[model samples]
Target: MTVTTPSIAVADPVFPGRWVGGASLVLGPLLLLTGVLLRLPFDFFFPAQLNAHQHHPDLMTVSYSFASAGWVLLWPGVVLLAARIGERFRELALWGGALTVLGLFARTFHAGVDHLAFQLVAVRGAESATRTVSETYGAFHVFSTLNAAIMGGWLLLAIGAYRSRILGPVRAVGLALASAMPLGVLKGTTPLSVVAAAGLCLALVPLGVAAVRSGPNPRAAAVAGRLLLLIAAGTAMFLFGQAG
Candidate 1:
């Protein structure tokens, strides 16, 4: 007798896994939006020119502000990858989840540091400004480095999925774009930020739409729930960014 593993192609039709992918697709963008808007205050409102000591426009605060949102964007990719290769590369999912959490941690601390840096710059003198610059840059460097690793993990997962034909080519491209995002900091411009922030963000929309139309599956229902959550969260984040 011989033992054989089940195929993931159309014959097997892993419906449950598809549901997982759908849910992630729906929720990921919403999370990204929420995180993005929270950090917009540092980017859009705070004028760097006001301070002669301003070195880099509080890059940490700005990047992590968007990073908070980046965490949300990662949900779908994480879920999709988990659904596909988790059984074989269980470590991938575990590491990917860890990376997401780590990214969030970095973002949270970075935000806190930004808060302190801002006050230091505002109330204190050039010495404080120097500290603020160093602190902000330090935080950004950490966050960017960690996030790049996370994106690299996702890209690896995406490559696995693409090779398996589980995620299709477009999704693979999106994952590749996502993997390239952390490098945006190297460019350090608004357009670069936009690419990093919202570029791959649209990749999951198709999955969301598919979930809504999927009909009568636990996975589809889950995806629908996530999609609604994302819409609400994204809206809130957007408003928060506008007001800030």
Candidate 2:
């Protein structure tokens, strides 16, 4: 009788990415929706937003913080989605993913500016803060060129998702609702913003949940090891950044 060799199990490279990316896809839109709803009571302008911030600092802080974090998380999730689409459809993934990522970055930048404007309300008062922000509102930045990307990206992504059969036609259209959201620093939410956010959640959350569930359950040790490594790396980078 011949002896048979045991087969070795190999790790899937996409596992870790899928886990984090799927979580991101779920959390990003929900967090952003929370932020928008929190700010909905305020008018969509620097003056009103600053006034809201000045009076309700805690509320505004939490709202904007959620928004900024969500923006940061979207790029990774978008990349993950693009990878799936690219497996069958390249052009849609390339343009849709690239432009969407860029647009997310630009929105993150606006979040930073929003923070600064709110701080200005404390330092210089809401009136002065409003005036300052208004005067400098249209100041040139490289991200200005990508403003259209924010809107166009969603449309392309919607089409791509539908064409790739990654999303149903209804869900793809729901995803496209994100294109309706207004962009800029110190702006507040509108009805359209709420709709857009709802659409985003509708389109991505189910897919995100499925993606996360589709992967094999990672070992507890592996999860712990990754957390430790992340903490160590974060500490190292923070120290390095301080030196820089």
**TM-score against truth, every candidate:** 0.52, 0.88
lDDT of each: 0.51, 0.83
Model 1 error, position 169 (Å): 2.8
State which candidate has the highest TM-score.
2
lDDT of 2 at 128: 93
For all candidates, the clash counts are 7, 0
- For model 1, what is the alpha-carbon lDDT of residue 110? 49
Q: Judged by lDDT against the true structure, how good is candidate 1?
A: 0.51
- Model 1 agreement with the true structure over 1-244: per-residue lDDT tens digits: 4332222222213543445555555566555544454444343323342242244445544544555544544554455545555656666656654565455455455445545555566577546555456555544354656755555665665565555454567665665565554332212234344554454455555554554445554577886998999899999999999998
Across 70-151, the per-residue lDDT of candidate 2 in tens digits comes to 7788777788887777777899999998999889988988988998998899999888998898899889998888889988
Error at 101, model 2, angstroms? 0.5
Q: Kindly give the stretch of ten consecutive residues in candidate 2 with the minimal lDDT sum.
A: 3-12
